[model samples]
Target: MEIKESTLDRVKRLKEKYALIGQDIDSYLDGLIYANPLTYWDYIEVDSLLSLQKPKTDFPDEKIFIVYHQITELYFSLISHELEQICKNGKNISDAGQDLGWKDNLDVNFFIERLKRVNKYFEALTRSFDIMRFGMEKEQFTKFRMSLLSASGFQTASYRYIEIASTDLKNLVHESKREELWNADYHEQLDNIYWRRGAVVADTGEKTLTLRDFENKYLADFHRFADEYQPINIWKKYQELSAEDQKNPLLIQRLRELDINVNVNWPLVHYRTAVHYMGGAAGDEKGTGGTNWKKYLPPRFQRRIFYPELWSETEIEEWGKSWVEEVLAESLKTEEKLKDEL
Candidate 1:
């Protein structure tokens, strides 16, 4: 009898809680009557995910190409999530009239952990470029790639967001253009971002269809994100730390790891893949996305270092050069082998 009374009491509590939210207990119970039990496929939306890889070509390898990019975009989204959480944790530092030394309120360990998570996601993505580098049949990929004109991974907005959220917007501008925009507003500087330099015609120096389409779709959203994150960006939050905390070895190590993982390591692997597929017998092929990728994709050329304040002058000067040369050498050998096979 005591157990029966306890069960009735629990139901009564649930009914009272539902009433507080303008829900009727009897109506909720009636709705539950028709609900189906969850299955793994339904819970995870496996069918919906599998349905996304719509290939433009009938080539069997095209699906692998499509799924690989989709997976990379998902990883970009994961990094973005961690960045957003970091911003949330530090938002209180931006409150009106708050003390400038607001790092005391922020949790340094929490920020480091979140950054480590972002690095792990990047590590997964950097390692996964092998799938793009070798997973598809070279001949089939070359054929199917022609079908994707002006649709390059260069237009990935989430990847852009990852960079914007990771550091100050100034750090993302090209080294040549940084001086010109040094005193400019964020909106003006946005026009001169480093990645925009990647999507221009080599001869005419005009925007490609890929860049124009990206701007049309995401320019406004990117600006909004920039404004929202400007005050709470990781670099700015790090600056808020006391000088001693700023020099913490663990924090500095994570920052440098993040810089290399996102900028150097990922771009070198990607550039190597581009060199392998596009660097054929005719020398540099015009990228299907319509950019001079040989000049644009390599980290040495792009020089997209996020934490420049952490590195020495020589390190910055030689950024992405050593590994890039190694990758290019390997790509040449691979290209020669492919030619021999054909």
Candidate 2:
């Protein structure tokens, strides 16, 4: 049989590639011959993924709860991946979860493209959050929620990482302490991060078990990523661009959208879901993890703006104002009736 020119070229390139390291292409070919064919199910690990929904209760909605949360974490990972790629400027990123040093490849177009992608992720999440809103039976969920104990969605590490990688550590600080820690160091800033207060005891002013476990698992990681990304976070990278490049309208719009998607829309959806299930809006139902979701999930309360500079003084001040009012108006009627009955 006559060999095609393309095949010959490929073999020649393969020989050169292997020869660079004093390796044999034939040995690699031999290994491939013995290797089993990759199946789609195996490659995607569908079985393992399907096995993950080990609900603590017999409720069918509990499975939906588990699967939806897993999907959210996957998206969070993708967001972090894009942020890391931007920070590192597409440098060698084969080492999973390892910091790729910045490459100074600040292309405004690249920034817009990645920001667009992150915005799309949040949009999909915001829309699909209805699954949590209306998919689960309230009766089934409230019952299964008891089975969950301290394992609340508040404990996820990926979302926290996204927040850290998105902006200055000062922005992540609780609003009340943000001024006090304005120029504080990483440790000080991390100590006052707003989300830490999300899962605190409402009365005793102590960490909940969920927050404690979360801190034990990821506090060091948070410290490391906060320090590593501080000088090159998305906002910092935006500032690193040329003055004219920073003026790109699409970049500004995408960033503002990102700020809303992450801070307002995302939390607003959770706020809706929590209100539906938790006897929320001036009630005493804490999250399964004892997270202060009433205060934490409401964007108006959290008021976490990633790109505060992109917004006007009034826009920043009124951040999440309309949504809070809209939801509060609706929530108050039902919750107030419930309060009166209680």
Candidate 3:
């Protein structure tokens, strides 16, 4: 015997079941908070965090910059939350009073996985930088550079959070301070927004690096490794370092063999953009926008580093002469050897 319920009756039963499940979920969430009420704010704050963008420029590209930065900050907040949670977990497991059933060694594995996600965000973030640079040709940047009088990305609280986090990890942090003539109500609004979200503005050190310094570091590394064996090796070293328990002496040697490692990609991207957007060798001097722009390096730092032997003027000339003579001799020998073999 088979019994089929009417459509209305079935729909009514489905609704009743969903309502029961919803109540059960709410009850579980409440129990979770009751277990650790001190951590309740983490849940509340996550929801209220990301609504803080106020664009003030009509320069269509400005919104792209603002949104990319906002998205980056949101990722940073997630990273900070994960780091804090991992640290707490580590401390909890080691504490004598509470026997956290979780294995202490597993905490390290969890942290590494969390950090790998952060690195993926960073990879995307650097690409965002590339996209922003693409948006601003020299002239477009100049148009807004003056408007930016005192304002810069370095001043952003999100960037400051990155700086502070880097400092905490014992990395050499550069601090720079430059006075700007312009200030905006948006700046005040940013402060107010932080308070509204119940988060404090990050205390960042002054900007210690200039555009020239940034260029020099990239250029120097590019020059140092322009004629290296392969760029892929550097990429490999970066992957090794990112792993949960990676330890290999060969990778370390490879890292030293390639001076810049992962950072080499940024300079490479910049050069590629110049070559594509600014036009090849001929258009180097002519600004992509209206402002004057320099030619991307003839071969570029990365190329030079990857192919150092080719760049040596004295060696190149000698090698060119010897190569021709050797090729001719080898051709003659090949004919003679073929005849003898026959």
Candidate 4:
């Protein structure tokens, strides 16, 4: 068959492209002739993805729990991806423990766009958490959870990476110790990241097995990632922008939204959901032998603000305070109804 003029023109351009790399265009064309057409199923690995839910127990709801967490981590990975892109163009920390070179190809619009994407992911996760909250029978959840041993959603590394990539290391220190640890050494700062507060033994101060395992696996990587992004984290990059760009209303709005999304809304959803599933014991149900989710998951308790300078004093003080009260009131009502039924 005669080749169409359009096809000949395309092939001519393709030959030039391969000639630049000194490759035989005809050889590549021959391979394409023998290649199978791609299918959506093979590309997405649908069968392998569906087979991932190997629930440890026969409890049907356990599969829901497993799949939901997998989806959440996937979202966390997306959030981290955007953050890494934002920081990629900025100067990295050096062996001297400070970013030395001045290099930034960052666009303010790019910053806002990526932060908006991160906010959307968090918003979607918050909305979908109801799936986990109401998806399982409380009887089944409570029973199946025991089979999980020290495993807990609190061990999510991508979520921790989100926090580390969002701001300076000092901001993640527990509020009560922020001032004391703000000037502390790097290892000390890592040791005091606020999440550790939730993983301590209640009576004797010791890390829970879940927290220990997490630290063993992730603590080194966390330090390296934090150091690499120290000079270019979202908050630090925001600080380094020109005063005019810093004052951009939309930019500020996106940053503040990110702060609230990660620090307040995300934790609050887990708090309320824990109340629904674990009931009053949710307060006591922190990762095994730890301070409990109530202590860790409540924004009012941690008061961990990322962009503190962006918020007014009153806004910072009242942050997550009202939401805590509302959730507690709802929890009380839930407990009363359970008592009445019993």
Candidate 5:
């Protein structure tokens, strides 16, 4: 009799709770009669994700290329998640017009942990390029690449968003172009962003299809994000830290690691892949995107330094040049050796 009464009381509480949400307990139970238990595959949408790797070509190796890029984009999404959280935390401490107040002294360790997570994600991405470098046969890649005209990875909006969220908008503009746009507004400076400048037609100096399409899809969204993040980006958030915290070696080390991981290391590995497949004795094969990839892909040429304030003047001046030249020279030698063996 006591057990029956306890069960009844529990049901009565559940019914009352459901009533608050305009739901009938009996109706919900009736619906549940036909419901299935969730499975791992269903929860993670494994089928849907597997279906997304539809290759443009029938070549077996093309699937590897497509899937690797998809994996990289997923990693980018993960980094963006951490960055968004950091931005939100920063905003909480110093919302639009409010002064820093006591809240601005919020813990610096939290930001350091989040930044370290971003570095780890980048490390994973940098290491995974090995799959791209060694997985696909050069001949098959060359053939299938033609099918992907004007569809370069340069069109990755998330990559651009990561850059915009990491630093002030002024820092992203090329040093040479920044002076000319020194007094220009944010929108104008954004127009001459370093990547946009790199995406121009070499001869005509006009925007390539890749850049134009990216701008059409994401320009307004990027503009809004830049405005929102200008005050709360990681660099600015670091500045908000206490004087001693600002000089924390661990914090500064993470910043420098992020700069190298994103700007120098990743780009160098990617450029190595390009050089292996499209360059060398194979001749000047154009990139699928139609940009001058030789010039555009290299870190030395792009010089996309994220944290300029952290590096010395000489380090900034010699950024990406020596290491890039060495890598390219090595890649060229490997290609030459392959030809000689054949």
Candidate 6:
């Protein structure tokens, strides 16, 4: 039997098969081009991306500065989006644990996937910062430094929120109050199960993981997932993982590297922006970008940063030590006063 092709029939066929046919055709063309790579030069949307450079100054390097910041902001957008998903995934996983591991297979996979996506975001953000650093020069940056008045890296809205979230998670997880912890949906779920039900150690006393530890976990999980997709490893437990075992060592290493890269690079960018472009850091008499440059940080953050491991102990000691010192000094003064009176 011959099939009649009318306007409706043709339209229906196109709708059903267009995407599949397009994908197949594109794959075939891509493979052919790869076999003979000279046939097609890689094309990118340069006009849209490059047109984004809106330099505030006529400085020759202003375009580079603008583009670099733009790129970093774009990466920030991705990072923030991935973080939101991870928050959701974490909430789901923790909530499932509260339910006694009643999570569906899909939920577990989805959570893992969210983590992988977040790690990828870190990688992208780090690389973007590295590129931005390249465009900045020691001398040229100094000229435009004053132009960046009342602006600072710390003022980035998303960065500040994420930073707050990171700290808040640790605070809620440690607090004895269930309601306090539950305020953050993801942490709340984790707290309900692990802390409330006592499934996990309430105090690893480990408190928050170090940047190094965070990196290791990200890399390990990424590698584990990649083994199924893109396997890589080194023989005999090298930093990089091999496809041999399901365990991904390299991915774990990559996570650490990426984490360190991001943590270190962010501060470096701020420093560079200040020193090179913003007047050698001395010109900021009034604090850049609404940041309280002169404000004394809370003692807790200082202790956690300077002596990270002894943060809790240092805080405890600092609290009591001052009063004890004062009491001893006062006693000595009293003794001296008595001796004089006698």
* Candidate that would win on TM-score: 2
Tell me the tens digit of each residue's lDDT in model 2 across 16-110: 87787688999998998999999999999999988888888889889899999999999998899899878766664344433456444767877
Error of model 4, residue 79, in angstroms: 0.9
- After superposition, the stretches of candidate 4 with alpha carbons farther than 4 Å from their true spots are 1-9, 16-22, 90-104, 185-187, 281-287, 323-342
Sum up the clashes in candidate 6.
16
Per-residue lDDT of 207-265 in model 3, one digit per residue for the tens? 22332333333433422322231122222223434353343323222222222212233
**TM-score-better candidate, 2 vs 4:** 2
Per-residue lDDT tens digits for candidate 5, residues 1-342, read 357988889889879867876778998778779899999999999999999988889899999998988998999999999887777774443343333543334467777788889989998998889899888999999888888877888888889889998987777787679778867887787877887767777656677888889889999999998888777888888888889999876678678778888888899899998888888595577654456678778887777787889877777787875553453354456546656876
For candidate 4, give the lDDT.
0.81
Scanning candidate 5 in windows of ten residues, the lowest lDDT window is 96-105
- Against the reference, the lDDT scores of all candidates come to 0.82, 0.82, 0.39, 0.81, 0.80, 0.41
Question: Could you estimate the TM-score for every candidate?
Answer: 0.83, 0.88, 0.37, 0.84, 0.80, 0.42
Pairs with steric clashes in candidate 1: none
Backbone clash count, each prediction separately: 0, 0, 17, 2, 0, 16
The reply for model 3, stretches above 4 Å from the true place, is: 1-52, 86-106, 136-139, 157-160, 163-342
CA lDDT of 232 in candidate 6? Answer: 15
Better of 1 and 3 by lDDT: 1
Over the stretch 1-342, how does candidate 6's per-residue lDDT look in tens digits?
A: 666679558656545454544544445446657784342223566566666776667788867777666766776677656545433333334432233443333233343344456556665665566555566665666567568643434334454333322222333233244346545553243333221221111233222222223334343443233232221111111212233422333333333333333334344444443434433356553333223332212222112121112124543445322342343354456546656876
Q: Give the runs in model 1 whose Cα sits over 4 Å from its true position.
A: 1-34, 90-105, 322-342
Instruction: List the pairs of residues colliding in candidate 5.
Output: none
If both were scored by lDDT, which would come out higher, candidate 2 or candidate 5? 2
